[model samples]
Target: MQVIATAGHVDHGKSSLVTALTGMQPDRWEEERRRGLTIDLGFAWTTLPGGRTVAVVDVPGHERFVGNMLAGVGSVPAALVVVAADDGWSAQTAEHVAVLDALGVRDALLVVTKSDLADPAPVLADVRARLAETSLGDVPGVAASSRTGDGVPAVAAALEELLAGLPAPDTTAPVRLWVDRTFTIRGAGTVVTGTLAAGTVRTGDRLALAGRDVVVRGLQSLGQPVEAARATARVALNLRGVAVEDISRGDALLTPDAFRSTGELDVVLVHPAQRLPAELVVHVGSATVAARVRPLDDATVRLRLGGPLPLRVGDRLLLRDPGTRTVHGADVADVDPPELRRRGAARVRAADLTAGWDADADLARRQVVLRSEFVAMGWPVPSGATEVGRWLLAPGLADELAARVPAVVARYRQLRPLEPGPPTAVLRSALELPDAELVAGLVRPPLALRDGRVVATDSGLPEPVQRAVTGVLARLAVEPFAAPDTEALAAAGLGPRELAAAVRDGQLVRIADGVVLAPGVEDRARRALAAVPQPFTLSQARQAWGTSRRVAVPLAEWLDARGVTERLPDATRRLR
Candidate 1:
């Protein structure tokens, strides 16, 4: 299915052309039909010449309802630009064409309406000449009179050809349906209507709406009930868990976790030479919001929205100066922009964005981004980006962080002489990294991870503490299993605090209560036990180590905990 929106001036036979093509009345309000003017949006669909169904969104052409017109055509991919033969291009005609051009709608059919009143050759030539300057350059034109039904067949054929030329919608893309109308049903529930731009919407699918969630109770396409619907089709969703009063026209139904809501954005102006005001009304999809603009350069500006919207990079927005009734377009460069609080920050940022929406530049600017967010923002992972677990980092970021780690560790050790290197969290904070997992990658040679902290290969201990610990280690080396008593340790000036510092320095290993041994005692014990018979009892192990029963019991348990030895049910042990 293909959707096309009507764009033209008031009473230029837009609704009349839609009615003639669809064979259905587009104007729903009686006042609009009575006044012969379209006040709001109207919808109608028809099967074209090739049996391809096309939905037409008839938008109001009056200057007063420009907001409503934007809402109707915001998501539609194609357009039917109507120009009356009797009245050549008017003010609204140029404005509507400017809107279509700003939105980058290229698939269009130029229709010269009311051909019976005057010869449409002059008007068709003039309209085509004006459209050639826009994005929809030199579109197919057909002069049709809805009153006499003359040339209607050719108009339908032109629309069919235009729809055929359009690229196929991506069904696998995330769903973002902009609601153009919301109403209530008596016995069923609340219903919302919109054009499903992409992705498949199925019954029972839960979607996000204005920070809340709602379930799709049912689905309909062109007034027919359907269990599932794909993109480029007009849809009406029966929603559960939300009241009709809670939802407005501009609200969007989104795939959960597929978007990020942001109040500030950086955009590259489509027309950089035009002078803009401080404030403008911004329109994207069906959403319209007031935004304050701060010029970063001639090409880029930052927009602070009145409320948060689910935006992404590469999205196009129409900016309208309400005071002057002028409209232009902008391309979103960054949705989650950095703050510009420092002096000259905005100028530097503008220089960064001056090259225009490059994915590699965006990755370099952010340094690190979650993989889900990078893809969710509608960009493929760039070629040079590095993938670290669930994150995508800028190219060569790991090497840069690794280069800064040794200096950080040296400063930390200098502050506290008796301790080892810094903790992972501290190192992460010092580097200003976003995740602690990144710190592990930054550890290079001469640095080892012990337990959960980073440490150097050699002890970073004080001179006095090193002297005391050396004496204890010399004695333990001769008598490997014979740990000194507390009185003996104190006499050597190695008290509890001093022993703890030695343990952190990797000079001593504290196994159990009143039992502190040399760093490699466990390896020595394993070597001694390996020579004994299989499944030796605790008594036999004590005699083999030539140590007291206290040291034997604790050492055996520590070996069991470290998987160095396995203890049997009968109080026997064997080397694992």
Candidate 2:
């Protein structure tokens, strides 16, 4: 697991404890060493008694640099919450605890350092009282003084127990890593270091670095290369092509299909101080995004953002207000973003926390339909749990519906094989589905859509009509050499409507009034009209064909539609 920095007030000896334990000075920069305060996140590692090694992130303790502290603690799961043995619970301490709680840090080991410098009794009491208000209050605190190494081993032991007991962060969950640090090296491309917030990262995986595809050329933990990493592991990834100038302190590295970039989101903003957000800045993990708050309740609010960001439907992120022009606000919970909203307001109530998945079958079905629409259009899925719990389509039934719909329609058509098929009500009666349901699901084109009446794409003409159309076209291929006649269609044993339906099915084409043709009839009609050798008058035309105008009109029109003969204004037909 990846380790992150501790939280507490200044001079709490977080750095001192880290130095005494890991024997590596956490103050890296020259100014920080002289100032004797950890102005940034300090990184170090130590081996526990259980033979498992762990990494530690020492966050800044000063209130002024809380944004940096949040950045340090963003990706870590279990934290080492430090408090001075003498000063007890300070203001920064409370804020740090709040940050930890908001970030959803589940497992943490408490450490009350500087036991020798001050009386431990009253301070420990205050510490416990302070812990009572947060998720980590139940966690045991180890008292230690970095100077004499007193209780250092005890603290290490407690940490080992905490590590062993630490709940394994869900690797199967969608991945989100907040980029805390971005730098470049001589040989490698841009290397971004951060904690793996959730899910797993493997070699050759393509991740959306700050919502853009960034190649993972390599991964490192505690300054050494590794193949794969899981949640809560502090890692430095050698990116393939992106540059350092493109990214900075507060960008997130996300799994492409696993997460979505959203400008609008639903959030539960908590101003533990009860201070409302006027125009506060939101910090999630290491990256801070600017957003405007629309509060629903004391604990819940909606954060509308200023830029595009990758946030999964169920994932959590921290929020903050920029204390300084270059800083962030206090942390808040990412309760899931509001539904896509444009030019309108949505109300999120207190019950919204347990309410996102509050969907029934009908609602879930709608959600699934909407989700399917999204998927078909190539959009991100909300979540499977959300789908199962609150989607408009429930129980993976949409997929089942997608498969069942086509099959049911296909089978229905098979059993009723007839010309023009059945009407909407008839097919729906056969399927026993509502009109709306059938229309939305099965009857919508290109699968099934109604033009004049309902028609399934898979529906075909009746067998006899198909055979009749075939024989008519075959006969016309020899003598008439034109399209089949509508009046003579009875010659092939089918009615005009059935013949028309066959023409619609591509068996024939209706060229003009009372005239129809099979495929390639136009070319044959031209040859026949040419062989007639002369423009015959009405009588000669009728006599030559051994038929009256009733048969001749339809036949002549068939030839006319095929451009074989032009009927003159004086009733004399001519070869064209």
Alpha-carbon RMSD, each predicted model: 4.0, 10.4
lDDT of 1 at 353: 86
Q: How would you encode candidate 1's per-residue C-alpha lDDT over 1-576 as one tens digit per residue?
A: 889999999979999889899998889899999998998989999988799999999999999999999999999999999999999899999999999988888889999999999999999999999999999998889999999999999999998889989899998888999999999899878999998888999999999999899999999999899999999999999999999999988899999989888899999988884478999999998899999999998889999999988888889999999999888788988888899999999999999888565788888888988989987776789988878778888888978988888888889889866667788998889989888877776788788777667788765567877887898889888888888888888887877777877887768999886689998887899989988899999988888898998788899999999999999999899999
List residue ranges in candidate 2 displaced over 4 A.
269-275, 321-500, 503-576
Q: What are the models' TM-scores?
A: 0.85, 0.68
Candidate lDDT values, in order = 0.89, 0.67
lDDT of 1 at 450: 72
Q: Output the TM-score of candidate 2.
A: 0.68
Give the winner by lDDT: 1
Among these predicted structures, which one has the highest TM-score?
1
